[model samples]
Target: MVEKPGDSPHLLVVDDDERIRALLQKFLARNDFLVTTARDADHARRILSGLDFDLIVLDVMLPGDDGITLCGELRAHQTTPILLLTARAGTEDRISGLEAGADDYLPKPFEPKELLLRINSILRRMPAAEPGAGVPKVLHMGPLRYDIARGEMWRGAELVRLTATESQLLQIFSDQPGAPVSRADLVARLGRSGGQAQERAVDVQITRLRRKLEDDPKQPRYLQTVRGAGYMLAPD
Candidate 1:
């Protein structure tokens, strides 16, 4: 995304409907965000090419590339948080959206105030680099090194880009290294109200984190599932 000069947290709102797009733009702007609106996936892609946004509000039903398709595409290279809007509220659909790498999803006909709350929550979870006060504490797993204080990972000299959710998950795991943290606990730590969907969302975030941190995500080495206990970190 292109760089714009502003202190406000910028947001990209993507939807096919002009009315919804305009309404979200106005509402988000009123909430003190720098809002950019896109009619569909192509328009959103064009805008993203030049400007960087703090978060994306995407609609699952788009004309060309659907929101799930676009979310997966963008998540591959960028860690900007995405909150999807969809009419379908099925468990499978929500799981698919999370598996595709969306940060969160909202069923349509939702209150604007609720949408605002989700947006703000996602933005709040974003990790920021701090000025190092001393040598930062690090945890290692094979070739990767994670700075515990800053919530950053590095493979040799190159830094790994982590989504906000992944960073927060890592931070939580590092807090109680060898101890298993339950899915319910993870959901609570993530600022999500406890629900089956939220628990599934936690699992998806764990899988994504494992792909980045483990030599084999299918048979994880560092991040391990603890049977009925939950998940834990086994740092070497």
Candidate 2:
């Protein structure tokens, strides 16, 4: 069925490449998604201030505050899912994007259909966690408290920022607190492909989450690694 206006998911495409921006805008629009284009980070920020989008497709190499930096900054306020487009397909580059809070990363020169698939996949899991995944209204982690329903974590009245991926992971772990969630399961839940690289990316996200949930991220307390299993969130 054809979707009506305002019923389609809205997307913000931020890229310095004119051709890519126009191509994505047209292609995503044809797919029934409402698309907004931004030439660079500054422009994206300006557009973002006045608009809300379900997802953001951002280019890594932008004019100012490159996409990674911008993604980190955006995570501080909103939990909009972000899929990064980068020319650098190296593992390190991909890990950097994940660390910065991107929901997914797609290398440049990728097929449009693949991008569409990724977009749809991410949107399908936009709710963060599956229904019946129960947890306490507020899960305590030492000085930190996570409001499960709100998907928010706070430290002494100050709200702790989590990337969209990190927030989703928290909700998944919260759903089954004390139980170990395998890296493969985490990758699947995160809507990423299964592979050593994908699992490594999941680990990077867990490490990032630990930084926020632990006073000593080096030796985590609440979010713990359970060898032979995976990771277990042992909340206090």
RMSD of each: 2.2, 3.5
Q: Model 1 over residues 1-236: C-alpha lDDT tens digits?
A: 22345788999999999999888888877778888889899999999999898999999999989999999999999989999999997888888888888888899999999999998888888777788578988998888999987888999998998888888899899999999999999999888999887888888889988889887899998999999999999999
Question: Model 1: how far is 45 from its true place, Å?
Answer: 0.8
Off by over 4 Å in 1: 1-5
Candidate-wise lDDT, in order: 0.89, 0.88
Clash counts per candidate, in order, are 6, 0
Candidate 1 local accuracy as lDDT? 0.89
C-alpha lDDT (0 to 100) for residue 118 of candidate 1: 92
Best by the lDDT measure: 1
TM-score of candidate 1 to 2 decimals = 0.95
lDDT tens digits, residue span 1-236, model 2: 12339889999999998998888888998999999899999999999999899999999999878999999889777878999999997999999888878889999899999999999987865544335666648899999998887778889979887666777888899999999999999998888889999999999989988988989999999999999899999998
